[model samples]
Target: MFHISYTVEGTWRLLKRQGWSWQQPARRAIERDDSAVEVWKKETWPRVRAVRRSATPGSSLRMKPDSR
Candidate 1:
């Protein structure tokens, strides 16, 4: 067992010398469901695309600048 006080830089150097490195955990939740995502892609996406494509004449899904 070793007990020593070190500044931030000194601590970082010590960790490097001891074969340690920084790491980041995954950004997503572990409980996320895969089957639900596939169902949405296959079932919901086509309906959404159809609605967007069925716009009226001279009108669009995008926001247009008001000419008034």
Candidate 2:
């Protein structure tokens, strides 16, 4: 180490002077499949969203049965 002290403000100023700026990371993973996403949106998501509560008569939200 050269024993150089740098503050956050000073480092940002130096970066800006060198034509660099902070940027947000990409929202999606690099391994994301665009075609798969499109297929899911077209073929699966609508059917999933259209399913009504009455269609699932056997399903329950309760984690445990109520005590009598």
Candidate 3:
């Protein structure tokens, strides 16, 4: 049985030579409706905000001042 082994660089170079370009998929859908999104946000954003506020009581993400 024979198998080919490739280093990371070798595989990347092979893909590059094949015309592959690295990219991330778009976060938003191309066919999304902006007005519908705005309406959903207006109705649901308050509840989302409330959940976070209720989950963490008196806790802050900010760092404490230096006490030195």
Candidate 4:
């Protein structure tokens, strides 16, 4: 028989800031024969404490310069 569990943290954008970051947490469970076992998992992403808005007044931050 075998069992495992784990936890992970970080933001999608900040994690991707360095490179192409597309991460998903690893799944864990127990393996056994004729055994009764229970499993549970929870995923939580903390809200962005400091969500950024436009860089300047009356300007769009996500807009590209070449598009204007």
Candidate 5:
């Protein structure tokens, strides 16, 4: 076990010298579902793109009103 007194960079270098490589830990949410994400990408994304492409130039959906 490495001591906390060592700097992060120094510890990384020491590990590398001993033939160990650093790996990033996954930061995914605990409740995330891969199938649900895939379904959204395949189904919902295409419908959203179609609506955006079919919108007219003068339509309210395509225009942002002045904030001032």
Candidate 6:
């Protein structure tokens, strides 16, 4: 019983790390929180990829701004 519980908890933690959204619309969890999580994602996600690219060395090529 203990081993089963431990395994289940470990799997859930791993899934959480993999971006499993408990606040998914189908889960009804986001509604109770007044959709704060969803709204935050809307405001935050836009720059995530850009920020990552800026942080990576040689991730982008420097070209003349007007280069076709």
- Candidate with best TM-score: 2
The best candidate by lDDT is 2
Question: What's every prediction's RMSD, in angstroms?
Answer: 14.6, 13.3, 10.3, 16.2, 13.3, 12.2
lDDT of each: 0.84, 0.87, 0.83, 0.50, 0.83, 0.66
Residue-wise C-alpha lDDT for candidate 4, range 1-68, written one tens digit per residue: 46653345445555567786666757543454323322211222234345677677574477766744
Off by over 4 Å in 1: 1-3, 27-68
Instruction: State candidate 3's TM-score.
Output: 0.36
lDDT of 3 by residue, 1-68 (tens): 47988999999999999999788876977899999989889997877874443555563658875789
What digit string (tens of lDDT, one per residue) describes model 6 on residues 1-59? 46544587788898899988466455664437657768767886785746443455452
- Model 4: runs farther than 4 Å from truth? 1-10, 24-68
lDDT agreement of model 4 with the native: 0.50
Name the candidate, 2 or 5, with the larger lDDT value.
2
Tell me the spans in candidate 5 whose CA falls farther than 4 Å from its real position.
1-26, 50-68
Candidate 2 lDDT, 1-68, residue by residue in tens? 89999999999999999999899876988999999999999999998896555654564565776679
* Model 6 root-mean-square deviation: 12.2
> What is the lDDT, from 0 to 100, of the residue 25 in candidate 5?
65
- Give the better candidate number (2 or 6) by lDDT: 2
In the range 9-65, model 5's lDDT, one tens digit per residue, is 998999999999977867988889999999999999988884445555664575787
For model 3, where is the 10-residue window of minimal lDDT?
50-59
Clash count of each predicted structure = 0, 0, 0, 0, 0, 0
